[model samples]
Target: MSPAFSVLMPVYAGDDPSHLEAALRSVVDQSVRPDEIVIVEDGPLTDALSDVLDSYERAQGDHFSRYRLRENVGIGNALRVGVRRCEHELVARMDADDISVPDRFERQLAVFERRPDVDVVGGYIAEFDDDPDDCFACRIVPTNHTSIAARARFRNPMNHITVMARRRAILEAGNYRDFLGMEDYDLWVRMLSNEATFANVPSVLAKARIDRDYGQRGGLSVTKAEVRLQRSFYRSGFIDAPILLYNLLTRASVRLLPKRIRGRLITRYTRTPG
Candidate 1:
């Protein structure tokens, strides 16, 4: 028998309405559908975004649950609230602008069934522009526990939106905290520190939207967050003092670069032809 899971997503007013629609459709049309989808409106949304949510709720009926916050809370707090509302022990994270492949959930579930020791599993993502059919690059990550743990020392080892995690483990690791752009990374570090195991499916299981503004998303503030996270890892003995210093200097330098240059560098190194 297949295990049931809840898909958790947070939508905000700033999201492109079309992208939100596509994201919702991807999940709803999955080969192994979610038992429930818990979507939290992080604050008041634009009429269009609200309409998109309304359409999905109407179509999905009881399978879809919606929660609205009185005011805007960041993704960290928003997700923390959403996770608490999930009925299933397994929770999958979805971004408002990304599209999960039809078999994504099924593949992730298979990993859980075969490896009970893995508390979290994510997969590669194909990055696209305005059209989903035109994928430009794929972001791949390490696939085993040891490799993932080592990678987490210097960078985020998994794609945030592509992850399916154990609800108990997530809550036990302190749930999500307000970390701005580094919220997912923060939770991952905490989970690793708590001895939660991680893995990634080698295939691209989702399509991530990337545009000119991608580079601007990680600025000085994000760099500060990374430095803070790296320090936490060092203090927790996840990495040594020398490794921490190396990470701090390199990450900070990258973040301080011009957005265009940073974007080019990221594209050049983190991406490969889809």
Candidate 2:
């Protein structure tokens, strides 16, 4: 049986209203329409933002279900709140700023259909900038269970916002939690520990905005979050000391490399569509 889908998006204070419209449109325009669209306004959104959302909702008709958060909460908390309100068995994540391809939902659905045992499915992403020449290619996670678990002990393979997770499996893994900066990684580790399998679609399913503004918090926050994830996995008995130490060192080394080199590598790896 094909599982119904709930597309969940959490809106933060700094989101671009125009961008939000495009993101929402992608969901509404999906090849396989979701059963519900759950928008969680993380806090009191700006008037302009609210107006845009209002317009989008009116246009979407009965396709969407919106909610407003009376008090400001962090992204992790916002996501948890939104997911709880989902009425479907499959939860698809959409970021306020990212753009999903029109076929994103359809492609993800196919993956789930092919691998009924898989609990989550995501895909590759392309990084874009204002300058066309500055784009890079990246994969969110591995496309099969073997590779997924091979790299699972270290870094996050799936982009949280680009994933479609089995609702029941997510609940069994304890759902989203307040992991501060590394909520996605924390959740992935917990899911892995529970023996949940993950896979990514081979095609690029979305575009991720990666710019200078993203790492502003000294990048220490992300690093710290990874450490917390490591602690979680260690405590869960999923990984021992040697493997954890190796992953930490390897991940740190990759981050230490220059951005120019990283960008070049990423660009070189991805093929330009004809």
Q: Look at candidate 2 and give me any clashing residue pairs.
A: 140-157
Local distance difference test values of all predictions, in order: 0.91, 0.77
The Cα error of candidate 1 at residue 77, in Å, is: 0.9
Q: What is the Å distance of residue 224 in model 1 from its true position?
A: 2.2
Quote each prediction's TM-score.
Answer: 0.96, 0.86
TM-score of 1: 0.96
Candidate 2 per-residue lDDT over residues 41-76, each given as its tens digit:
999989878987899788777767788889888888
Where does model 2 exceed 4 Å of error? 131-134, 212-221, 250-274
Q: How many steric clashes does model 2 contain?
A: 1
Estimate the lDDT of model 2: 0.77
Estimate, for each residue in 1-274, the C-alpha lDDT of model 1 and write its tens digit: 8899999999998999999999999998998999999999999999999999999999989999999999999999999999999999999999999999999999999999999999999999998878888998888999999999889888889999899999999999999999877889889989998999999999989999997336635677877877777877888788898888898887767888888888888887777887
Worst lDDT run of 10 residues, candidate 1, spans 211-220
